[model samples]
Target: MASPQPVDIPSSILIIGSGVFGLATVYSLCKNPLFKDTRITLVDRQPFPTPDGSSIDSSRIVRADYASPPYARLATLAQTHWRTTFAPSYYHETGLCITASGPEQKYVPSSLANVQALGTDRVEVLTSSDDIRRICGLEGGAPGSGNTGYVNWSSGWADAEGSMRWLRGEVEKLKRVEFVTATVSQLLIDHTTQTVSGARIKNNSSTSTTTLTADLTILAAGAWTPSLLDLRGIATATGQVLVYLPISATEQTALQSHPTLLNLSTGLFMIPPSNRLLKVARHGHGYTNPTTIPHPESPSGDAITVSLPYTHIDNPSQSVPLEGQRSTRTFLEQIHPSLATRPFAKSRICWYTDTRSGDFLISYHPQYKGLFVATGGAGHAFKFLPVIGDSIVECVLGRTPEDFKGKWEWPAERVPEESWEGDGSRGGPVGMVLSEEIAKTTSKL
Candidate 1:
C-alpha cells in the first residue's frame, strides 16, 4: 500500500517508555533513512530492563493463532521474524494448544480457521476433552481441562527478557538514541497552543526535576500511559495474575517439550517448563485499580478517576491476591493435578493497558499537535517486539498498514470502557476491583 501524505519530519523526537514499542521504534528509526537525521531520546523512569514492566517477563506467546484475521495475519508475519532474524535463539516452537470450555468455546473454531487460512499445516484439531489432554500432555491432569481445542506446532513462545535484552544491545550498537533514566512527572504542554513540547522528568537519584523538550513526543508508556493523560474511559490498566512454580529437573525435562495449554473459558494458561520454572498466567478481563489523580490535560487542576497500574513499586511486599491464586490453583487441579497443591515459588500482578476494544492506541493526539500515543498492550503486544516499531513509525509518518489503518488510529469520540465490544478473545470474570480482590486474600474462594 502507498504511504499517506507525509507529515513534516521533526528535528528531534522523544519517546517515553522502554518497552517493546519504545525500543523497537528506536531500532526502526535508526534504520529508516527518513529518520536518520532526527535526534532521538528515550527516557524511562527505571534503568534498562524494568523489573516490574510487563514486557520484562520470563515468557510471552509468539503465535499467529488469533480469531481476528488481521491480527492473525500480522502475527504470522511477525512470527517469520521470530523464526529467522529477530532473537531466534530466544524463540521456541514447541507448540501452543489453545482450548476452551463452556461459552469461551465460541472463540476456538474461529481461531482455528484463521490459522488454517494462513496455510499452517501443523495443526492438530482436538474435538474432545481426551484429545486436549492427550495433545497437551495433560493425561496426568484432571478429568477435563477443556472440551475442544487445537495444537499448532507452528505456534510457540519467546524468552521475553532475553529478546528485549538482545534488542537493547542492537539499538545501543547503532548509538543513535540518547537514553535517559528518569521519572516523568508530567507532560510539558503548551496550554494556549494545545501542543505538547516535551515532559517534566525527575531524576530519582539527584532529586531534581528537568524539562525534556522535543519537536515531537511519543507516549508509549504501556500501562502507565493513562497516568500521564486524562484517558479515564478511553483506556485503563488491568492487572492480570501470574504464578511461578519451581519444578525439579526431572519434571522439567519431562514437560519442557509439551505444548503450552491455554483454556480461554477460564483464562488460564501454562507454558512449557524452562529453567526449572513453570509459569501459569491468565489472559482475561483482569482486575482494575482505580485511582484518582489531577487531570493531566487540565491547566486548573481537575481531578479525574482512571484505572492506572499499581505494581510492586507501589507495594514491595505485594503478590498476587488470594482470589487470583485460588483460580490458578483450580485450573492447575484440572490440568496438572499433581501440582495443584504445590507451593508457588513466586507470584506477580502483570498489568495490561486495556483499551475499550483491546486495540492499540497509536496515533496523533486529537487535541495536541506534537504528541502521539503508542500504548494499550492489552496483554498481547510482546510478540510484535520484532516489527511493531516500524509500524509505529509508519503511523508517525502519516502512513499505516492497510489492514491496521482504523485498528490503530486514535478514536474520535470517547466511550465508556465497560461498553466496549472486545476482540472476542478474552475470558474470566469481569468488573473485578483489585482492592476488593486483595481484601479477600484472607478468605478462601
Candidate 2:
C-alpha cells in the first residue's frame, strides 16, 4: 500500500478522542499560526478527561530517566513544560526514587549515565539502603537491603486529572476548538477514493447517530484505537492493574515528603500519597481481551473490534486481576513492610495500547488517506504530555522527528505477538484473555 498523502494544515480536522494525544494535538494546532483558521472538533465516548482514559489517572510519574536517548530528550523537554504550565497545583516536583535489585541493578547506573549524557546531573546516586531511605525519606531499605537506585531530583509527577483539565481550559480559549461527548462508532470512508471523510458518532445522551465530516481525522483514542482501526500487528490493548491504598492524615503527610518509587526491572512503581491514597502499579506483562464482531463486507466476515463504549468491558469499576493484586502486594511488602497488611482502598485494571516494540506509533495510515493515528502509549507516553503533540503535528506535516524515523511508523512485517505475562513457562499472552469467567473470579477476590 502506498503512503497516504500529507495535508500540512487541514481546514477542518475531526479528532475522535480527547485523551492526552488528542487534546495535545488540538493545543499544538491552535498555537500554530498556520492553523489559525482550522476548525477543530474533538469527540470522545465520555466528557473531557474521562475518568477511564489513560491520561486521567490520579497521578503519573513525570521523569526523564529513559534508557533510550530519544525518549530521554523528549521527557526532559516535557519536564520543563510541566514545571511551567501545571506546576504547584497539577504538577508536584516531589522527585522520583528509582531502585532495582538482582539483574535489574544495571538500570541504576545506566539511568544515571543517560541523565549525565544530557550534560546535567539532575540525579544523585545513593551509596546504600540507609542512604536511599535518608536521601528520599522512603520506608524502603537501601541497595544492600535489596535495591539500588538514584533520585532524579528534577522529576516528579503530575496530577493527571488536574493537568487534563488545565489542557482543556487552554484549548477552550481557542475559538476553533470544539468539544463533543459521543462514541465514534466507525470511520466514514470513501471506498472509491480510499479516503477517510470523518467519523460516524453516536451521541452519548441520545440514540441518534451523526456523521461528522472533516478534511482530516486523527485517531488518538488510546486503548480503544485497535477496536476502531485494524492495527493488528501494530498495536494491542493490554490491561495493567493498580491498587490504591488509603493512609491516615499523618501517614499521607510523611509519604508526601517522599518521592515516587520504582523498580525498573519489575515494572513495579509506587506513587506517593495523594489525598490519603498511595498507588502501586505494574508495567510488566498486561492482559488483553480477544474481541470480534461480524462484518459481512469484510473478506473474513468477522472484524476484530472491541465492544462499544469500550468502558462496558474495561473500566475503573472492573476488578483488578488476581495475579496483579498478588504481585503488587508482594512488592509493597518487600519495601514498605509496615504497610503490608493495610487494606487496599480501591483497585482496577488500567488498559494500555501497547506496541510490540515500546515506542509510540504516530503516522498517516498507509491504507487510508486523510486518516492519521497517534497512539501506542506502551504504558509510558503520559510523561511526554506537553511535547508529544508537536511530534504528531510534525508527523502530519510529513516531517517527523529524526528519532521517530522508523520507530513511529507501521512495521513492514507482522511483529511477533507479545504475552501479557512475562516470557516464561508461566502465564503468557494466551492465558491473558479477559473472559467472563476470569472477570468474575477476580471480582470475587
Candidate 3:
C-alpha cells in the first residue's frame, strides 16, 4: 500500500458511499496507469474495518441472469474479471437456476429469447422439468405448478463484504487514494458558474462540518444517494428485505449437495451459505422512498412487517424488520417444506433506491456541471459492482459508455409502462408485461 502524500491531498475526484461501488471505483481508478497522477478521495459514514457498518456479506451467491442482454453481457464480463484477477476463493461458481411456474411462466421463454439474441454464452433455456430438477436439485413439484427453466453457468454468488474489504485494502495501498469518514450534507455549487465545486460534509461524530473541494464528484450513496443530490433533482425509492435462516442438519446436507437455486416459479431464490446456513428472499417487491422513513441509528431486532403499498426506506445501519422475516419464512415454508420447522437465524432490512423506469440512473445532472449522479440500481445491481465501478469512474472523468446513452433524458417520465409488480413467483403478470416490452425493444435492434 502506498502512503498518503501531501501532493495527494488535492484530489481530482471524490466518491461518496463506501460500499461495493465506491470501493471498487477507487480500486479501478488507482489501477489505471493513465490516471496514476490523479488523486481520489473516498468518503463514507463508517470507518474502515468497522463491523457495525453495512457491508455485503460474502457467503451469498452472485449471478448474471437478466431479461436484458446488456445486463447479461455486463455480468458475464464482471464474472470473467472476478475469476481471473479477483481471488478465486472470494467467489463460487455454483450455477444459477431461474425456475418459473403458473401462466406467467411464459416470461421465462421470452426472457431467455432476449438473452439468446444477445449471443452471449451466459444463458441457456431448459426445456424439461426433469432437467430443471437434475440441474437444480429440486424435488416434488406441486400440482398446477408451471415449470420453465433457464441456466447460466457464469452466474453464482461471491463474498460481497470480503470483496469490498480486499478492494479497500488494495486502494489504501495506492498513494493517491484517501478514505475520509464524513457524511456529506450537500454538494457545493458555484452559482456564478453553474457548476459543482465540492461538497459540504458533516463529520458523523463531531457534528462539525467542512467543505472539501474536488474537480469531480460521484454519488454512489446507495439508498441515501438522493438526499445528497438535492440540487440535481435526483430521488431514490427504497424497499428491500434480506432474510437469513438456519438449515436443519439434514437439510443443510441436502443444500450443500444441491446447486444454488432460483425458483422464479415461486418468486424466491436460495443460496447455500458457506457456513451451512441458507439465505433466501423475493425480488422486486419491497421498494420504498428513503426520505419518508426514519433512518435507524443501529440495526433493529424485530419481525418483518408487510403493509400494502410498502414504500419506505430505512437506514442501512438499522436491524431487520419482523414483517420481512415473516414473509420470508412463509415463502420458504411454501417453497421448501423441509426447512419450515427451522427458525430464522437472522434478518435484515435493506433498501434499493429505484428509478421509476426500472433502470439505473447514471449521468451528469442536466443543470449541474461537474456533478455526476449514479443511483436507482433497482434489485440487481450488487453483482455488477465491478462494472458499475468502472462506469462510475468513466462518468466522473467526463466519459460516458455507449450502453449508458440517453440515461439522463430530461423530464424523467414515469416508470416505463411495462414495469412489473412485486411477487415471489417468477412469472408474474408484471414480469410478463416487462417481457413484452423487452421483446419489442430487442426485435427492433
Residue lDDT tens for model 2, 1-445: 2275756679899998888899899889888888888899998888766877888888998888777778889999998888785434788888887766554346567667888788766678765667666765656663323356788888889888888888888888776788888898888877678888998999878899998999999999998887677777678777777899988899888888678877665667788779889898876666767677644124345765542223423453666667677778877776787887788988877778877677788888887788888998888888888998888888888887998688888666655465322212111123366565356576786
Runs of candidate 1 with Cα error greater than 4 angstroms are 1-6, 141-144, 442-445
Better of 2 and 3 by lDDT: 2
Residue 193's lDDT within candidate 1 is: 90
**In model 3, which regions exceed 4 Å deviation?**
1-11, 49-55, 59-61, 103-107, 114-124, 127-131, 143-146, 231-235, 248-253, 287-323, 408-445
Model 1 steric clash total: 0
From the highest TM-score down, the ranking of the candidates is: 1, 2, 3
Q: How many angstroms is residue 291 displaced in model 3 relative to the true structure, after the best TM-score fit?
A: 3.3
Model 2 weakest lDDT span, ten residues long: 420-429
**lDDT (Cα, tens digit) per residue for candidate 3, span 1-445:** 1111122222487888876666777777888775777768888866764343334653545665666556667777787877877745678786777777644655566556755665668665766666766676655443211266778766678776777777776676766777888878777776667777778899888978998788777777766664555412233444455667776577777766455766665456677665656787655444342223222111232322111112122234343444445556655555566665677676554555555544566666666666666666666676776677787666555565676555532224333322533212232122212223334545654
Q: What TM-score against the true fold does each predicted structure earn?
A: 0.97, 0.90, 0.78
**Candidate 1 — which pairs collide?**
none
> lDDT of model 2 at residue 292?
78
Q: Which pairs of residues have clashing backbones in candidate 2?
A: 129-142, 143-147, 285-420
Cα deviation of 49, candidate 3, in Å: 5.8
Whole-model lDDT for model 2 versus the true structure? 0.76
Q: Candidate 1: global Cα-lDDT? A: 0.87
